[model samples]
Target: MIRRPDSLKTFLQAGALAGLCALALLQAPKQAIAGPSGVAGTALFQQFPLLYQGVLVEGMGGAFTAVADDSNAPFYNPAGLDNIQSSSFQILNISADISYPSLYPTLYNGVSGAGNNNQNYINAFSSVAGQSLYARVGDYSNYTTHDFAIGLLSNNQMLGVANASPTTTNLGSLAALSDSGVVISGAYGFFNHHLQVGGTLMGLYQMFENIPSLSKTQASALSSTLSDNLSYGFGLVGNLGAIYHFDLPLNPTLGASILNVGTANFGNAGSLPQLINAGVGIDPDIGFGRLLADIDYVDVTNYLYYTGDSLWLHTRFGVQYQFPEILTVSAGLYEGYPTFGVGIDLWAVEVNASYYTEEASPVPGLNPDHIVSLQVAFGWM
Candidate 1:
């Protein structure tokens, strides 16, 4: 078992300093963030632009606030790191993801035939209007022992969608985002370890590109230098979280967190919105396996600027069953859409996969983006 440091005072001081510095680094703009530049017609509301999302968490419908016992704790609720009994290190964690792959072939053929004709381009884009196409690649590695943890993470995401309005000058829209960062976290327990509080400092280098109106002429002259339009910046952010363990049946826990404390301004790349999230969870050993259930309310501050969004869009529910060192299965609801995930562990190597749907419109179910994600990792536990 990992041993606590000689003095809790030192740890607490370090944690507090990290949090304050992150928040002091940026000033939140008074005006609300503007919508994607130049896009015509309705666009999706963006909420909680997290730096990283793990497959296991996504599979569990993203309701991990109260059940953050793994490496992901630093991102969800660092206080959960207090539950770590043994030191763990992940040497490598690699992932790849795709959204709506079923529609790829049709889109590829349509784009290939459009050529330089404006009407053909419109027709091709209209066929897939309101549909989302996306792909991503990412990696994360971390080490944790008891009340302290550190990690590195990076991701690249590309997304495209046709203009929702046919009368607009745009044929389609495209966006690309990249984030690379380091995370330093610390936690402390109180009241005989029943209550834990923690904080994290995240330093990030971010780049973004948003072409909300890709006209026919632009599409015809697309070249490798298209990334010249990207805007890049660097920033630091902070998170504070706490978890209270209740002496009740099923080992109930309550968790809450304030993320992106003062919001982070990434220059022309845009800003990260502040969010308040909370959750309740229970973990019970049921003879044959362990059962976990969690319910969460995310983005409690309602950073979403769009109308038509319901409470269901911010509600998340999930359940997972684990069989010792062998396999794990999970299911849940995210943004009112069903999600499923599976994982296999074999001492030194682990593999996980998940299927989930994300909403791309102000209304749930109106524009669904189905995603398939997989991860492989090598680690010591």
Candidate 2:
């Protein structure tokens, strides 16, 4: 927890001044450009990018490509679906996260005392503080030989500044973005079940709304009409994956996948980038539990197509221990940040929880964001 100083009001004054300067820059005119210079680059991709899915994978720090065997295989390495023996179904899966609001003391702490003059600017700064919510519901079941699954996923992000004045209900400025989609996935095994291949198709819808910094004159009327400014669109994308299991000790597995293969677009809004990912996993059975370790290399093409920045490497490593069928514990480094999670099985239901950190920017120097997620899943073999 951050300690609050008695001079927090003074800090708010300084922050308000900074906000004014930033607003000035945002209002400046732009030049017409083309090619790479015109591209929005990382900022565009950072908005609502497809995140690593599933509480188990997140707890393992997103190193599940070769270890995928459960319903989430569709998002990780669909080929692993062939490993399933029973026709399992995930009745409902929902997950949500929020950055620790405690870090932004200016917005929540000592804010009620901010002077009327600094309140608007404080709100503006709070609007872009990186807050988001996500939820998904899906089901996966195996057939006689081939395995298949379908799911619906949605995400929403909001940033805004709200007035601290007791008499006002107006938000100073706001931006909200959302994405919703359906995924269809299938997998097949060959070569005596040594090699498996899988694919996923997605249909997506996206929406975004931004309410510009409010002027005193427009605040009253604009506050009431903000919903009218929303814009939305739809598009499609696909993923292909394969995994190979070795006949050697520990049943080590190697996996590879191409995600967002065709650079799916959301009409004129934007496009999700194509990513190439590969991973390896080793699971050795111990007397009382199973020890699992996995490592992954992601966004392979980003190094060649874009600049050779280290962030493009996007490496992840994780280790997990499963105590029979009662509980599982995991810890990992996700793109260099620490993550921890656990799963508990009770009868026919499983509950999972994880804490993960994400860098606001791959370029460094930005503060990290923390999220805690809890998921409940019910299924029967």
Candidate 3:
């Protein structure tokens, strides 16, 4: 019998998710001293956008910096690897199973760009109502992310919930996560055919576990687990890229890049600020495989937050195909306009099983949701 207004509506939904993670540590943009709005302004522990989209020309549709090379042109533009005569290292991976109020399953891991599947098929058919249970969720919901980049990156991202039921329980370790971070990059290439440029240095470490249970076999009426206050800092990310190719008669390839404008400090509650991205890529010479496209622009809103308000300004598109050339086909679209995924490519390995829906209100998000992804890469030239 857990009363007291249901424990004050579960700490007001965990203090409105800790005031959106204390306003992302006071709208972090480096330059310090921020975090206040009760529980720091809570947004569920902040740091949510960016699950490995560090350039690969945004995986297909978002295109590739002029058909990216010398292995990802130093995070998409170390001046396009300044015509790297030769010298390379590559290994990339992306995994996912994202479905919100839409398809009904949720496990958002790292994203590799290119999405929009008819608004996830009309939010998975408008999350069924008749008998309920379509993508039904509640116990801590879902969100997962991981990135293990070698000499160029060593990823980390986590959202919440691995357990939750009639009375709530998640004893620990689905992979015990609350928040994680790390990204260190450096690149330089010049002339001949590759003109690349690079810069990246970001660090993050987080752990927030506030468990409060009072039923489900009332162990002590209200279980315990509380953690917070362990933020971090350090930012000066940079990337300016270029790639141009025209061997003619379809030997066509074009690329352009701009990423992470600056700022990143998570130390004394402040900074995740500064972000700018620009893209374009074309790889033509048609045949059985290889076709790409991309476009991106993010100001994070208010042109740069003063108190921000409803802004996810998004525009995404993706296309992939390895065809009889070895089987690999994809599709895309994003933001409330959904229409998202599908994948599989053996050669260098890429997998994203299936996805497609257009919401007819049987149950999903009322209709748009279906996503899957798996990626592994290696090639040194």
Candidate 4:
């Protein structure tokens, strides 16, 4: 059983926090209008951070802009598909299980004590608690030749929370987020494979859902809301990427990508922002293993949202060591937060795990949120 705050002051503080959340939502940037949020304005946009490709990239703190050599290249930098030597198919699942230690207690307190006077508190807690689960799944298939490569990809992300304890609370909410799409990408290599250029044509889909109002009565009769509150939108987008490999020491690589170039209007939800990514990577053989290091910069154009700071430039750094096909370890910093990941490869299947932190709110004083991801990938070479 979770302990509840006893003093009125603590209760007031919780309410104030909820109020701030609502105010923040009202003042949120244009891009956040269609995103998920709590009744009191706690934005759930951070629940779906910039999408990364696979467990390998997440393990490296999302520093794959220049190191995109595998099936994930279409998502990270399509130009990297030029490096693929064989036909391949791969699928990945990435999930972020976020837990708010302080927020959950307040929520439990608000819902456990149900009275007419506390109805507003109960609604607020339910709204905030309903965004606890964030997950994504994707698949990539590529066919490569000496000078050309083509691939098909699909990816989806979902954010929602559920409490289905029949004996306790039956409240639940779901926010099916934007940015799931199917992409057809192709890459062409030139100058003896020293340079590669690629492009992706994406078919986009956006979705959203919610329970209008949550109360003890509604919680008990929530089965209907769960089945009916779904909304969707469709659009298209384009991406272009390029990579140049230099035969210098350690085989250094330089890459750049312009993502989401076209408009994806989710009706009233606004347009998806365009992003530019650039990075450099080095792969050096060190006898026992291969050491890989990368430095990347992600710049968002036409959006000022999340990350209390006004800087549009996000920095990422990652390093990984691979002991042939058996084991790999990675670590890095993603927007100033520490991230660690490990991978085990056994010929046909690979397993990966990562730990990282993300900002739950862009407000200056709030604590950061954490995520744990486990992935299993199947590959056919």
Candidate 5:
């Protein structure tokens, strides 16, 4: 058991700070946050973008075998770090995801007797298009997320990934976006007890461009205006997990982690933030991390809670094969898109790529969308 230090006051302060960080994380360009960005609207609506979706899951095809290779392992499965044999190192993870959301307003509207001119239908399209700008009020812009991450894991903490952009809410000050970053994650494990727990600390900043509101005549012009600033708040995400090594010839291992159990900020929204992700793997013999095949349930992005009555939940299935001399494969499904990808490690470089095809098009009359994606990963171990 981890002992509690004397002051309850100190604990509260740290908790408060973490909550604020959570809030800052959800803040970003409005409509630009749909799908994986989280739903837009209300405090809860904006809270979705803060979800991590477990990035490393991509390489392993959603399989977390070593658990320690990812710095964010604690956020996904706390028990992951328990398997780590190394002391400290810096790791960089960068993935670019592109998504084109389709609109079936005509079908829904026609069936519901709400014509194309229906206020409800228009609002839906306008909502998705104007989301991030709507909340911020003036930055009327939309683009898929271009993500970048840099991390360092040492002794007990994982650091990097600054989420300073105002995504869910309209902070109005661009600089506040810089203040919110996540880092310094720590873990505690009773390896013998088979129980391990980990936690993360977050910093928050918020700001936005005055995009303009419905009531303003010159709201369009406001998009050109920009502002920035900082605020202090806190919240936290945690992992509670255990690994059981069965007494068998193959010695299969069972493991589970309840992630985001620790609550963090939700911008001004109340928090009930918790994520539970689990995985299991068996090893013939453990060498360096290993060449194994595993599959898992993982989130590609957060589902934003739009209006009090509307919510979007986004998640996917990840299947992967590892430790093979040939190419490794990964397949996934999200929203209405089906994706297949591949990876290969040669010499000292890793090359990866994926393509997507939509279940149906959004043009109301045309065929569903057909899209493709390409990506590559490189590193030196």
Candidate 6:
């Protein structure tokens, strides 16, 4: 049964989440490392850090800049907060992602004695080199009403890549990163709701550790703990966004945003580069269900660097269909890789799953890493 709660209860729920976020940001454990975090492993890819990437948004090929209408609005494009019709609060949201297609088989073979049985060792090592393997876990919660939103988000990931050069004595490189933060956002509508402009401010606590080069002998003799090499930092970031709705067929909406304006600097560690993204979303009034389609050009500034010689890696396209209050399905292309996702909602509980591939090497189609993600959430609307 659905029983509407009083405003006081809603406010209390929001406050609890707020307190938790504040505590997380202020009470991070201190680390006493001398080297800067991510100094080694991150040399492979020059991409920026995304403090919060909602599962639903990523499931849709990360094309939510123009279609950010849900709890993810505050992180994607705060201007979409104006689309909320009523108050909503999320009590719990957790998600995890891991590389798929079973890298385990080959990894196990290499670890066991079977890999060295013949020239198979060379083949296996060659295949694994330069390939990125990763796992991630995250939790998020938020409260939103009308044109205002606030949320807490945390994400942790471990990424590794094997060394391919013949001159290097290192076995591989590994990096662990964590980000926890609070985000507050606000927006205002103009021209009778035809346009919306918004801004977001985020306070973050981050920690990172990287092992640039390590040999098997050194690994066997290692004595350092996960915290021994860890480095910590803090940052304040901002985002600005605007959306314009056209009064034509399909109800087209054009959106643009600048994330981490002027870059998000974390002292002693590193910084997340600024990105400008633009996209368009359309909602067609069809019978029996809701349909949304989006096309986006993300990180426009890096187009020349990422796609000048290789395949275009900045385009995203997605489409989703929702069946009333029960199920939702989505599909799209993320940087030329296919992605699919599904969601089921029951009462106040929701479950979502997605499958996609990420290009780890400089060029697309060279080194693809298959990944799967799952999420569970509890909320009140």
Candidates 3 and 4: which is better by TM-score? Answer: 4
If scored against the real structure, what TM-score would every candidate get?
0.86, 0.71, 0.28, 0.69, 0.48, 0.81
Among these predicted structures, which one has the highest lDDT?
1
Kindly indicate the candidate among 4 and 6 with the higher lDDT: 6
- Runs in model 2 deviating more than 4 A are 1-44, 101-146, 157-177, 209-229, 303-308, 311-313, 364-366, 379-381
Name the candidate, 1 or 5, with the larger lDDT value.
1
Q: 269, model 2: CA deviation in Å?
A: 3.5
Model 2: worst 10 consecutive residues (lDDT sum): 31-40
Q: If both were scored by TM-score, which would come out higher, candidate 1 or candidate 4?
A: 1
The TM-score, computed over Cα atoms with residue i paired to residue i, of candidate 2 is 0.71
Which tens-of-lDDT digit does each residue in 1-381 have in candidate 4? 112334564455335434423432333354344442331122344334443356677778788877777656766777777777666545443333334333455655665555544455446454555345455565544444433445554455554444322222335444445456666777876555656777666666655554534445655444675456655677676666777666567877777776655334465433455556678898765778778888887653323355435332266789988886689999997666788999887756767888766544454324455667777766653
Quick one: best TM-score, which candidate? 1
Per-residue accuracy of model 5 over 1-381 as CA lDDT, tens digit each:
223333564455345434433443343232234332211222322322233323335433344522333444544554455555444332233333332332234223432443323343334333333221101111101111111112422111111111122122221111112122444455444434233444444342322211212211122232333322122334443444444443355444554444444434445323324333344555555553344434343331232332112111233344555554646675654333455677665634445555543222112212323333333333442
In candidate 6, the residue pairs with backbone N, CA or C atoms under 3 Å apart (3 or more residues apart, or in different chains) clash, namely none
Prediction 1 TM-score vs. true: 0.86
How big is the positional error of residue 281 in model 2, measured in Å on the Cα after superposition?
A: 1.5
lDDT (tens digit, per residue) of candidate 6 on 1-381: 113335565455445334433432332221112222343227323332456666767778878777777777877788889877787777888998888865656755674553223343444545576666778898888888999988887988877776674112465667777888998999887656666777899998978776777555444344563456678899998887777666668888787777776667777656665556778999778888999889888765542244434434777888898898779999988878988999988858889898877777668887778889999989974
lDDT of 6 at 126: 56
lDDT of each: 0.74, 0.60, 0.35, 0.58, 0.35, 0.70
lDDT of 3 at 42: 30
- Which tens-of-lDDT digit does each residue in 290-359 have in candidate 3? 6654443332222232223422233445555545544555554433233334444454454444343222
List of clashing residue pairs for candidate 1: none
Score residue 283 of candidate 6 by CA lDDT: 77
**Model 6 poorest 10 in a row by lDDT:** 27-36
Q: Worst lDDT window (10 residues) for model 3?
A: 136-145
Tens-digit per-residue lDDT, 278-323, candidate 1: 8999977588877888899886655554322488888888998888
